[model samples]
Target: MSNNLALNIEKIKKEKSGIDVLADIYFHAVFGEKISPENLERFKWYGIYAQDEQQNYFSIKIPLNMGELNLIQLKTLSLISKQFSDDSLIFSNEQKIEFKNIKIFDLPKIFKLLQEVNLNTFFEAGHTVRRVLTCPVNGIDKTQLIDVEPLANKLNETFIGNKKFENLPNKLQIAISGYEEGCDVQFTPDVSFNAIKDSKEKILFNVKILGNSIGFISPSQVLKTAIAIANIYKDFGERDDVEKSSFEYLVKNLGLIRFYDILNSTINYKIQQSSFKNEISHPRKPRLGINESKIEGQSYIGCKIYDRVVQSSKLDNLSSLLEKYEANRVKLTHKGNIIILDVPTLNAQNLACELEKISFNPFV
Candidate 1:
């Protein structure tokens, strides 16, 4: 980090692309492919969960868009948990899956296996744009006004693989949601867009920077606005200290209005000041319960689990229960709860009891 190679500590893996090298590492180990110090450091960028704190073993943080997980992916996670990390799939507060206690040599096989189910551990950590989070309820809940899944996915696609953004000053946390009441850790992100109404009552997102309301942008313009704000961060965010160069520090030092105007200037349009006024505070609502979907006769059963600790066997059991009860999908909540979506009304209590057997009681 102190060398003349790169000023930023986050973007030092230049010998080969991180993802490609992971594949190479997996296949070339017999030919003396060894993990360099820099390669090991860069692994976190792709959600490779090796940590100085955890030591030797690693964890892969697989992101879930709106915490959405189909049955196939759930089975994949169960397999990863059962084979690699004991029997637990730890749920991150960001609505992602963490596969823990994995050996370094087994990563390529694991990554290849996850790819079969259309999942990859990409950009879940480091200075890059981390995971894109949205309302967990999404299309399932009556409380949600617009399903921002598309927007979240679009943002994910726009930011995750882009090398230009890989070396920003520090981690740039972002959240986009259509939840009127505000879900998904709204205020804590570096940039947050929460859906709201204008004077005409049309749904538009009120943009907030560092938890302070800046202005509003239309739904179609959300992506544009996101890119603009990101560019502003890349351009103006301080990089000297690295530790103090996070988006929050940039906002704090530059002041809110200064950063707001910078964002507006970058996008080449004025952000209309929003008339809407409300501060959301529920970090852990809808944590455990039978949530009725926006569609009648369907319900989502949510269960509270440890934020960072999970038994691999219990997760395998959870996947089996989902299969047994005919649930189509599961979503992870920001509060570290798991939501089994598309359940019939008749099967709701049964799902709860089954989860209870695994000690993840939905009722409690």
Candidate 2:
């Protein structure tokens, strides 16, 4: 299509108010033709983007599962990449796609192409699950006694897909942590499962409910089994009042037994006394090389993320430094801290200095 055609198409799309009408106009403008009713239903999954004169862009929300991006979506994105000004396709920090630097006139063509290619299946925007964050390493941590990834995934699937979870009283945060120094941000989550190892090497998990980042950081031990714990939250979790909703609020008002009873019906396992103890260390003054790792001769450095904002620029620099310094992997801690594992003795001091320059203090 010509540049003028693209521009005019985008103008019409932006002028239209609702997504359905906008999509219809877009399809006609792009193909110089019409779309069948069945085809329109297929296009519902895709989103729209329009750019105004100020270089700002807007996205129409689309809901899709969070997994691997499909081939069709990739192809649509590739088309957008060619049509748009920049190469960068903005994946929002919350994991949604942003079409960058496209003129308002091109929106209809882009939207039509997105529909024809079935790209909507991969695009999800304005969805509430965006508020929930899970560590990729949740169940895979070598130090973890139990894998909580399954439970976390189950919770997300149920919460997002089920109409009941959409009405949640407040945004709920959940984390699964394994290791003496937890990798998952357990402290900040409303509900957290931390894996603990006993003297006999028996691995059991403790469910912490109602833990918050603010002053109300009350850590209560609830269920030992992850499934039971998740079910408990789902059962007692208030959906009517968004303001008063949260696992913490429910547990506080209903008391333990009442909460346990609700979850007990769904969970087959027996509720055992929590053998898990609060083994996590309190935060220390910001410094380098203060916290040692389980691996001998290795230490961790805490980098205060700028305003707790994790950026690609900082991560890119850290990735390069890790390779240069012989660090094995970078672990993001729940407390908004990043850990560089397996630092060699010879490079530890130098690495610390370099990290300090980047606003990260080596554990002292």
Candidate maximizing lDDT: 1
Report the lDDT tens digits of candidate 2 across residue range 99-142.
Answer: 55555456666656767854442213211222234442333334
TM-score for each candidate, following the candidate numbering: 0.88, 0.49
Which residue pairs does candidate 1 place in steric collision? Answer: 87-311, 87-312, 87-313, 88-311, 88-312
Question: Candidates' lDDT values, in order?
Answer: 0.74, 0.46
The TM-score of candidate 1 is: 0.88
Candidate 2: list runs displaced more than 4 Å: 1-170, 179-188, 197-201, 211-238, 273-292, 295-299, 305-316
Candidate 1 worst ten-residue window by lDDT: 275-284
Model 1 stretches astray by more than 4 angstroms? 1-24, 27-34, 49-56, 184-187, 274-284, 306-308
Per residue, candidate 1 scores C-alpha lDDT tens digits across 271-328 of 9874333455553255467877787888888777754577756666777887788788
User: In candidate 2, how many Å is residue 179 off?
Assistant: 5.9
Whole-model alpha-carbon lDDT for candidate 1: 0.74
